[model samples]
Target: MSTTVTPTIKHTALSDFKEITKMRLSLSVVFSSVAGYFLGADTISLKIVLLLALGGYFMVGASNAFNQIIEKDLDALMHRTKNRPVASGRMTVNTAFLIACVFTILGIGILYSINAQTAMFGAISIFLYTSVYTPLKTKTPLSVFVGAIPGAIPFMLGWVAATDNFGIEPGTLFALQFFWQFPHFWAIGWFLFEDYKRGGFFMLPTGKQDKGTAVQIILYTVWTILVSIVPVFGVTGQLKLSIVAAIIVLSLGLVMLYYAIQLYKKMTEKAAKQLMLSSVLYITLIQIVYVIDKFIR
Candidate 1:
């Protein structure tokens, strides 16, 4: 009985840790950073890749843990977030805070080993996410815009880690992710409107799902597609894209745009969810396409 209970306790603790850190979200963030690193790297170094992955994960995890800590009360009010470790009382606030502190130290230390710029960006991402964006969630819809800053940093952070220089290459990577977030997040806001409201969060640009919000989603999707193809024009320095890759990316973007347009026409929760899912696929596929093109071109 004692042995069986010990394993159960350990499993529960691990599950709680994953919940507080938002494991899946943190991993996706790490993927973006590693993809950027590959694009910027002249010759892939396994050590750098490992560092970027671990450091990026730790940093994102720390940011999310802090976000949960601040939003514990708010999270408790939302059905979607109610089961989170802190929100559900599965973990103490002090324990969560300690985990965040350790992750912060480890993330920054690991990134500093890569380069100062990478570490600096990681630190800034944490600060902006926890101190600014998290707080603004309950206050304004514009928090999505502010949140995009840190959200976009990981992609560019990888390039900086590889090159140790910030330029049009990294800048373009940043712009790509930055613009992409608006439509992606707003679609989520549209579908989860009621849940967000339960938490006192105003995430949509129009503060309600309407034609105005749909138009903004369509507009941003267009902008995201445009930014994605700009590297094919050869203006982005080391970040050039082949025509074949650009066409593939354009096709993917158009597919996502189709979903965005559907949301506009239907203005239904189902359409909004489709747009949100498409946005996720768009970002992931484009990152894969871009990295593959860099190698083949």
Candidate 2:
């Protein structure tokens, strides 16, 4: 006779699973992929949409889990991450690794059901995030640039999933999201500099809050806005935004830019937090507006 895993250990593992996966963050990334799918899909099926969401969530969860596994010791040193399941000793590295393996296999299989390209990109995003970006955090600020590649993939992944092709349209969408990540993440880095430093992660462009960092944030905000409105000029192949929708996107970009400018001026935690919120709003609303335009026009 053998004793089974106890309820206490089981419950702890379950809770630790959620903590290690960073469920909310994973879900947010999935939301971007869903928006991409909706925009690229000509005839949306409930089943495919659901599968995309599930696959996306699983992929991001796996990436986050692997990142935590790699950084468990470092995470234990930072107040922001000290309570994370693996960092807190609530879960073993072996358990986390097994969970990550399961999520990765399921995620890739689900995306493959949509298309091979989608599956391949999903795998790439996880690989970049876990294998590349995770290790670079402590080495160089250029890690943010490396990290943005994977970060930007989901938005275009949906388009690829729907069309089963990589073309100018998805490329444009990818460019827009890629540039947006700089300002979005830089704002977070600005506010959380101390917490990140505790973990030996230097994310800011200058690795400190200063004029140079603020200027780069503003510049990226400009780049993100320009890429977003390019479809209005009808340069892209599949994606074309109406003037009205472009105007709305432009207005939202201005709002984000305003916050970016404010961060440069104030250089305070409040301003950085405000910019972070604006970046979130800008991306979410812009994606929604684009999908709405696709349907309306």
Candidate 3:
């Protein structure tokens, strides 16, 4: 009789690296950064755009990886996040920590090579996201507000990377994204209320997905719409939007508002999901409109 030996497969560091980065989310973050770069830069260069996107991706990815490491236990409790690499035991805490460190350093270094202002913003985003927002999620509903600071930075960071200065242009970009986040996240909170509760996260402003929360969502949605159209008035300095773009953006906002109202009336998972989808479309469409208006006008 002959005995056969089976070879054991060892996990590669590269596979673990991908898991820690949360590639899908990183890509989305990079998209926003690139959109901001396009809108802010006077002349868009492919090389700079690529660098900003990659740098933004690594910075946001590092924040997310550290967040997972910090919230691994809580994540295990939530069905939506239970299978995350760290929470599921597929990646160890030490491994995740090292990956976060590497990404953070690489991200900041790349951004610094472009401009120091961008690098500083990137570092601050990571710090606020990981050090403040992650732990605050379970302690207070205000965590969303705290997280928005870092979340809104990407758009402005792109501007700083290109222009090497922070002014009305980047400020407007920051404000638009800042207001946009409230509705986007609240819609998500509405849909994931149950899952969030499992992890002791108070994501909704009212701490419950009820009429009050829905009202707040609508209020913020209105504010976001107003800010998005501000540039059309041509008073926002370098960041100006045209009448056509304003109309297009307003139409998208109305669609989002319609879904928000529907969610308010029905207060069901389906309605919340629709609102969430609409929120996503509203942001993306408005960003594209801003860039288009910049070139057209």
Which one is best on lDDT?
1
User: What tens-digit string does per-residue lDDT give for candidate 3 at 105-202?
Assistant: 99999988898899999999999999999989999999999999999998888878878989988898899889889888988898899999999999
Task: Give the alpha carbon lDDT tens digit for every residue of 1-297 in model 1.
Answer: 355434333338889999888899999999999999999999999999999999999999999999999999999999999888999898999999999999999999999999999999999999999999999999999999999999999999999999999999999999999999999999999989999999999999989999999999999999999999999999999998999999999999999999999999999999999999999999999999999999988
Q: What is the lDDT of residue 118 in candidate 3?
A: 92
- Each model's lDDT comes to 0.95, 0.93, 0.88
Global local distance difference test of model 3: 0.88
Q: Model 2, range 1-297, lDDT digits (tens) per residue?
A: 998975543446666777888888888888889888888888998888888999998999899999999999999999888878888887889988999999999999999999999999999999999999999999999999999999999999999989999999999989999999999999999999999999999899998999999999999999999999999999998798999999999999999999999999999989999999999999999999999999999
Relative to the unseen true structure, what is the C-alpha lDDT of residue 145 in candidate 2, on a scale of 0 to 100?
98
Q: 2 or 3: which has the higher lDDT?
A: 2
Q: Clashes in model 3: which pairs?
A: none
Which residue segments of model 2 deviate by more than 4 Å? 1-14
> Local error of candidate 3 at 22, Å?
2.1
What lDDT is reached at residue 174 by model 1?
Answer: 95
Instruction: List TM-scores for all candidates, in order.
Output: 0.96, 0.95, 0.93
